[model samples]
Target: MFTRILIANRGEIAARVIGTARRLGIATVAVYSDADAGARHRDLADEAVHIGPAPVSESYLKGDRIIAAALATGAEAIHPGYGFLSENPEFVEAVEAAGLVFIGPSAASIRAMGLKDAAKALMSSVGVPVVPGYHGERQEAGFLAAEAARIGYPVLIKARAGGGGKGMRLVEAPADFAAALESAQREGRSSFGDPAVLVEKYVSTPRHIEVQVFGDRHGQLVHLWERDCSLQRRHQKVIEEAPAPGLPPEVRRAMTEAALRAARAVDYVNAGTVEFIADGSGPLRPDGFWFMEMNTRLQVEHPVTEAITGLDLVEWQLRVAAGERLPLAQAEIPLAGHAFEARLYAEDPARNFLPAPGPLLHVAFPDGARIDTGVGTGDRITAHYDPMIAKLTTHAATRAEALSRLRRALGQTHIAGTATNLGFLRALCEDPDFAAGRMDTGLIGRRQEALTRVPPPDDAAVLFAALAALDLDPARPFLGFRLWGSASRRVELVSGGTLVARDLRLLGPRHVAVEEGDRSTAFEAVAATPDGFRARHGGRNLHARVVRAGGAVSVLLDGRITDFSVIDPLAVEAAGGAAENRITAPMTGLVCAVPVTAGATVARGDILVVLEAMKMEHSLRAASDGTVEAVHCAVGDPVGDGTLLVEFTPAARRPDEAADG
Candidate 1:
């Protein structure tokens, strides 16, 4: 084993690598950008180095800077944790040239699997089955359209060098092919600096299954098993599980064998994942699976595999990099119990899963579940990187039990200062199709309405928020009571964008009555704990926790987080004025294009500007027919959220039209 190693990444994966290195008595060095100077991963390392600024190009993606940091810190090996330069073959070669071990596969292996088009070709050359698609060298738009036509309708245009659903488009008809291809190419060029692409047949109901495989210098290889990652939204996996539930044994065996063969074919080393798309419209079969691509580094969902198999994948990466043989033979690897990992992100599920970066005021996870996180309370989710908060995983003797634990664990998780997908995840866990293992990549899309529904705040939650806002302590004497009778006060609160007035009356030191509209309820606080309160409402005991920040209060009760905004009745209101026609950015990002210019007349729904952030592009459209008055931003300019990008003037009306009106 090496004396020291440098982690060439940030966030949870870097922290995860540091944990294993610390347990092995090895010193770990962390490299951070300006935005991540105070991040949890930097604090967890024994030594740290400042790479550059926040943008990936100037910081994490700079291979030379990362190599220099590794050498300067005397790190014998560099572990590129799954993102940025993790799968960059050039970075691996550079680390090796600096006389430091790259704790992953060789440059040749990564290059072999770098481009999807070439990788699929190589896999097909071997015995591995591949999806029928056009992987040729033609890049002309006309030629690609011909290929898509040949492949039939509902084809997928994917960037050869893209992953994580970036630079991918699904076109269901021939008329949409050209525009989708152009969009995919543009994103591919912006993200990967490569505009090459490939066309493939779109699978209607496919299940995403990937196998974890590890190899060493001695040519020893072993498969750790499979994970079902079919639950997805916007082409990204939301929940993943190991020992895929209801998967046939024959299919599992075939997938494992194929994964091992792919690794050997590339002479792969260290940890890697071979992803396949299996037909889920019917029963699983050995011949119904096809190779999608291979991830040349550790996966974000590796924890689910670890939970099922009693092995640490990071330790194995280190051991393999240190010239040790595989830790366990293929037959000797242990597999037990079902495991599920839910990716808890600081994002709003209702707003098309928009990334919402803000401070984490209160963060807590439930017991009996393993939480791997890189942020804690008081940490801010910056816009410079991915907004994933943590990975919560649960394990049990059976799939049903494991899923139940996951549902409860998610409910126990408390968060504040930003919108989260906790509610959406809980709903997905309770989905009948999901519970029965009847899932596909389109499950979330088909059930989006029910999954992303935000329940209205109940009376109990509203009352709790009111109490917290007023700083009312039920245990205190008098509690601002009237001399003759119980003191009463009316408070205004807002929940889910609706303002509501609630009446609160203090009955005694430990009792209170709440009235909203035609309903009224009496409650008594039996005990007040640091974490929450134990109270009796309507003859039933209830447990609730309150998280207060500024004028916002989130009441967590009965596995639901209901947020209420305290309204200030005396605050001055802005005068009703003519509608301002300025279009501002919805989030911090770089302007990718300005489709409209000043003096240009555009129809409603016309694209005005395109903003790219967090690896996705969002097109700002004209809300109404208007003439562009000004274009304030240009392509390549980084703008903060709410920065004005364009201004428009309503289209002028003709004299005859005005007379008719």
Candidate 2:
């Protein structure tokens, strides 16, 4: 095996690769940008090198800089751990030219599958099942529209050059085709620098299943079963699992064989995934599924595969790079227990799932479960990178057990100082359809309301927070005692823009009553664990915990732990003179484009501007119909969240004397 390898990436994937490399006794080098200087991945590596600025184009995508770092560190190979420069064929060529092994497929293999249109054509020529779509070279908009017309309504326009759902759109009718195509092309150009797109049939009930393929230098290849990644939001996968639930034996065999064939067709080596869109009716057959795209590197959900097969794919990559061929025959790799992985992101699911970036005051992941994370307590979730917090994975003897374990693990994950999608993930795991293995791409979208509903903080939770905030000790004789026979303590909390106050009355050392206006619930303390507290309230048992020093309180509810702060209420006074009518940037990012300017009047629903942050364009819209008083920022400007972009006054209400209608 190679002595050292440079990981040409950052974040959790880099940390994950480092862990495997360490176990195999291979030294790892980490390359970081200015924004990632203090990243966990960089600190975990045997050696670290600074590449360039925080912008990916200046650092992660700089193939020459990465190769130089690898050479300087005496790395035998470079592992492109997904995203950034992972699938770039030119980067592969550069690594090869520098006489350093690129721990992935060859340039030729990447090129064969880089462009969707061309890859589809190639797959068809090789007799691999491909979706019926326009795979032609013609880029004329009219030509593409005509092709979509022939394919019928509800077609998919996908960017040919990139993946990760960046440049994809679904047009439901011919009337929307032109606009969708224009937007898709613009986003495509911005994301991949390629405006080319292909039209394909949009599967109504689709399940994303992909076969993991591994090949070696000796021309041997094998399939490592499959993963069902149907749980997605805006085309980005949110959750994934191995050994697809409800898959028919025949279909499973066909998908495995087809994935292997696809890899062989490209002379593919190392790890790659051939993804397919399958019908959700029943089991996935080779014929029922069509090739969607192929990821040319190690996948983010590889842990689930590892949990099921008990195999280390990264070690295999190292072995193959060191001139080894097929560590084990296809027949020897056995599929064992089921596994599930939930991608926990730092984003607010209620507010349209906007990315939330800030310092992680306290981070506690579920113990006894596999958690792949790059950030720890005290680390900052930078606005310059992906807002992924961690990937929580679990394994069990059965699918039901795996799902149950995952749900419980998600509840135990405690994160603070930044909003997260943990609540949504918890709700999703409890979703009946999801538990029954009947899931698809639209599952989250379909159950949007229930998924985003923030469960009300219960009596026990409130009592715990009150006790912590009041600095009341349970051992004290007068912790909740007062002068009167009935003593009441009131505390305020800020939930988003809403202000809520809770009244608490102590019955005894172990009992307390919490009231929010007309409603009241009683809570009884159980005991404290290593992490936090467990309590029972109104016949509903809950868990709550506290660490009093940092002005933050961690609470465990329904087996899931989340952190909330003791709102000082006095903090809002600090914003005394700031204009309240202004809409500001929510995070640090370049102003990709300003669609509006000073004196431009807009309605509440109008999109006022677009800010590109972390490679995603976030549209800032007017909160109410108003006339612009000032525009503080301009196009191409870098802005931080709360940096005022525009100030406006509500539109004047015309005088109506109950006359003219």
Task: Please provide, for model 2 over 408-467, each residue's C-alpha lDDT reduced to its tens digit, 9 standing for 90 to 100.
Answer: 888878787788999899889989999999988889889988898876665666666666
Per-residue lDDT tens digits for candidate 1, residues 1-661, read: 9999999999999999999999999999999999998999999999999999998989999999989998898999999999799889988888898888999999999999999999998898889999989999999999999999999978989999998888999999989998889889999998899989999998899999999999999979999999999998877899999989788888999999999989888999999999999989999999999999999999999999999997999999999999999989988998899999999998888767878888898898889899999999989998888999999999998999999999999998999888899999999999999999999999999989889987777777777777788786667743565645648778788776677787777777677777877778888874566866667887788888988889888888988888778788788756664345889887888998898899898998899999888888878888788789899999999999889999887665434556888
Q: Which residues of candidate 1, in runs, are more than 4 Å off?
A: 481-486, 507-509, 575-582, 597-606, 622-630, 648-659
Tell me the whole-model lDDT of each prediction, alpha carbons only. Answer: 0.89, 0.84
What does the lDDT read for residue 425 in candidate 1? 94
Clashing pairs in model 1?
none
Tell me, by lDDT, which candidate is best: 1
Candidate 2 achieves a global lDDT of 0.84
TM-score of every prediction relative to native: 0.95, 0.93
* lDDT for position 172 in model 2: 92
Residue pairs of candidate 2 with colliding backbone atoms: 411-560, 411-561
Say which candidate scores most in TM-score.
Answer: 1
